[model samples]
Target: MSNDLIQVLQNLGRPQVLVLGDLILDRYIWGDAERVSQEAPVILLQADRSETRLGGAANVAQLLRGLEAGVSLAGVTGDDLDGRELRSELEALDVNCDAVLVDDTRPTTVKERFIGRAQHRHPHQMLRVDREQRTALDAQRSETLLQTVLPLIEKHQVVLISDYAKGVCTPEIVQQIITHARQVGVPVIVDPRPGEDYSLYHGATAVTPNRLETTRATGINVQSSDDAFAAGRQLCEELDLKNAFVTLDSDGIAVVQANGDAELLPTRRREVYDITGAGDMVLATIGVAMADGVSLADTARLANIAGGLEVEQIGVVPITRDQMLGDLLTGPRKTYQKVCDLDELAQHVSARRQLKQKIVLTNGCFDLLHVGHVHYLQQAADEGDCLIVAVNSDASIRRLDKAPDRPLFPQQERATMLAALDAVDYVLVFDEETPHALLDRLRPDLLVKGGTYRRDEIVGWELVESYGGDVKPLSVIPGVSTTQIVERLRGQTILKRPAVSQAHAPERKAG
Candidate 1:
């Protein structure tokens, strides 16, 4: 990555993200599932605890806050108890809720989900009751919402429209928001409702639709990756959107960009606990990352990791920066290896494998040791009995970096650093660019990297595939990087060195 990009990512903080659309409350009733009740055929839920959280557009705002983004929400809510609670929640998150209009004509939208759990079995959702209005917002109310939101639109870097098909996201409101956002040069993203016409989201920068929503809106049955790519592309073209992504549960996400590239981000293998607000987490992370100047590919990777983290916890929970940092630190660092002399590295790999121990092979250059690299190696160790990190030599670094003064640390120093990490079992230095030859010989059970690279982008992927081994990417820390630290140190030195020297000269003479 370029120094400028790294600097931008490290300083990602509180970029204004405007959220306008359907506002709702997500209430969860948790308990154990026992025998059926005498009065009905339904299983009895031994009530344990219940909680209420911001849902719909409100949940999106919470996600933005969790990612350390400054958020402002614009929508309509009922003038009732639920609306008050929703407002309080937004306030607690430090989100600007002044644009959330209160109307007495309808009740606040609430989805009450009753979950039943049992030991050694999967928790099942027994019932979900929703309170909402499907009708369009009144002309006066729509105008009122526009009046409140239009002025604030120019203040944000990115605008998100989270519609749940509630009256708040009328056709007129969506069109107005899109138009104003375009005029002001703010990127607008949408999490659209199912069965709703895509025309409502015309001119949006991007729209994230789940599998069912995509199928319903595009009239395309997505069964495979190709089908998903085709559907996503068709939808983007039809809607005139700059980008479109369809999130397939357990199958990862498919993205179609304006440049006509269909990219598939495979799902990270995980045991899901709860899927509540997973989509919200994805949308918020991607939107915030993009606003913070991360590339589209990086944004997608962050979203995938955020979604994976959300499903590990119960209820409508937000993934915090600390949690993301921890996750990135606890996994194995992934490497890209290009092989020039496969036979040479293969010989060394075979000799090591003959010892009868589980060989964990990971390849990457340890140019700058950071917390993210440490966590990735630790996570990779958990996948196998031992870990091996192959470092690229100085020549190979020049090939990959395309810079005369790159590889901040030499190969020997880099290998020694990797060896010092407790998660790493062994460290080897390779002169060539790719590690395919080495991987073929090592035949490791797992190949790991930081979560930024797509599966298809991994070098030696074919070798791992042939050997029945899996390749995984760990999450990247949001605001941590070696380049940023170096730049800061350099800037500080330039600012303070002359003053320090001048001040110390008199003291030295006195001594």
Candidate 2:
């Protein structure tokens, strides 16, 4: 099953997914709590940094992009700076926000969380304050939004409704969306709000509700698989839904279909740090998989894995396709398996950054794989949690004019040699003479170079420093060098072998 899913992921082409719901801006004020307030009993927080990210349905769009889906977000935000920033962020990720209407009457939904840490430990949320209006939109504004969003359903393969119980997800809009999408033969999935009256989401294809929401809607205590199945079955029957998905925190997801089929898809136990956006991640994964026409069981499995990966992180972090692929591997991976192409490495780097891991990158033409090169890479690895070694291609080395025939090995050989070392987490071959383009894409946390050049003279130093990344120079081993090794080999009487012709070369297996 794991292997099957891996094949599914490898061929999971980009599918257009339409998301409709409330848009929110999540703001975090990070600080340190070391002292008490002079006049009050609250801890005095010394703020250091502030960050803003997408929330609510906007977060679902971001997650869909991370999963390699073309996303279009349709919702409402206030005609304010926060709304503009939210739209800008989505656009940066290539999400279509043309349907993101603005209402000057209500403020954009903003959830401001104050986080504090003591003695340089892990940060925790101290308090959260919400700023917005919850009243339903006026008749005029609602009708205008419906007119804009109704036509977009035809352009998408699937429609996802993320209702945070905000003013945007009114009864009329939800029913119209479902009815219109059904008429066009498009599936509609809803992440319903926790309430006893779920009639707003009736006649939908599927509905995803957490345990609390299911328990409330079905009047059943969802503690075991049987309980969850009972609740899911009740929802599917009462709401006329084809399927009901109940998320059971650590146990997994319980799914019940209208045809009297029921099953509990168990999830691997993960260390729960923060489950801020697990539901959104699950919704995004389902939308992508269903768009690709994956089976419901397989889609549920993928969603479980995505949601599990989400909880291991601190806050609302997007899950990437590479992260899913890495988690789907059944056993330990070989060192050579770490060798990746440019696109795969970029995806892995994005996932690592979301997990708060530091990345270190270094580049060179490691032709012979000597101790000096190994020592430099080990030092670079010590600077960060993950070290990526970018090897120069054979054509690039020749362009550098190092010598008449400088590189003794091919790019594949050099990359395999580098991947065999414990210090390197990933090895990639670049055709560029300089690592500038690679640096721009990976954006490593630290850029390390091993040579006699000064810190400022290193390539990409300015580019690295521009993004708050550090640049350093490792100590060059004086007595050992690849040039010296080649000279010594030339002095020795070595026997040369004839090159094998293409027809006589061994047949290689398909990748």
- For all candidates, the clash counts are 16, 0
Candidate 2 per-residue lDDT over residues 1-511, each given as its tens digit: 6646776777787989999999999999999987889999999889999999899999999999999899989999999999999999999999999889999999999999888998767788889999988899889988998999999999999999999988999999999999999999898999988789999999999998999988899899888999998888888899899988888988888878998799989888888978899999988988898888988888888899999999998779999987887786522447667788888788777666755789999888887888888888889989987899988888888777666776899999999989888888889998987888989999999998775556786778899999999999887676555665666678832223222222111100000
TM-score of 1: 0.67
Instruction: For model 2, state the Cα shift of residue 311 in Å.
Output: 1.3
Give all TM-scores, in the order shown. Answer: 0.67, 0.67
- lDDT, model 2, position 287: 85
Residue-level lDDT of model 1, residues 397-457, one tens digit each, is 7776433666778877777777766677567777767887667666887777653566655
For residue 466, what is the lDDT in candidate 1?
81
Q: What TM-score does candidate 2 reach? A: 0.67
RMSD of each: 17.8, 11.4
User: Which 10-residue window of candidate 1 scores lowest in summed lDDT?
Assistant: 502-511
Off by over 4 Å in 1: 1-11, 120-123, 332-511
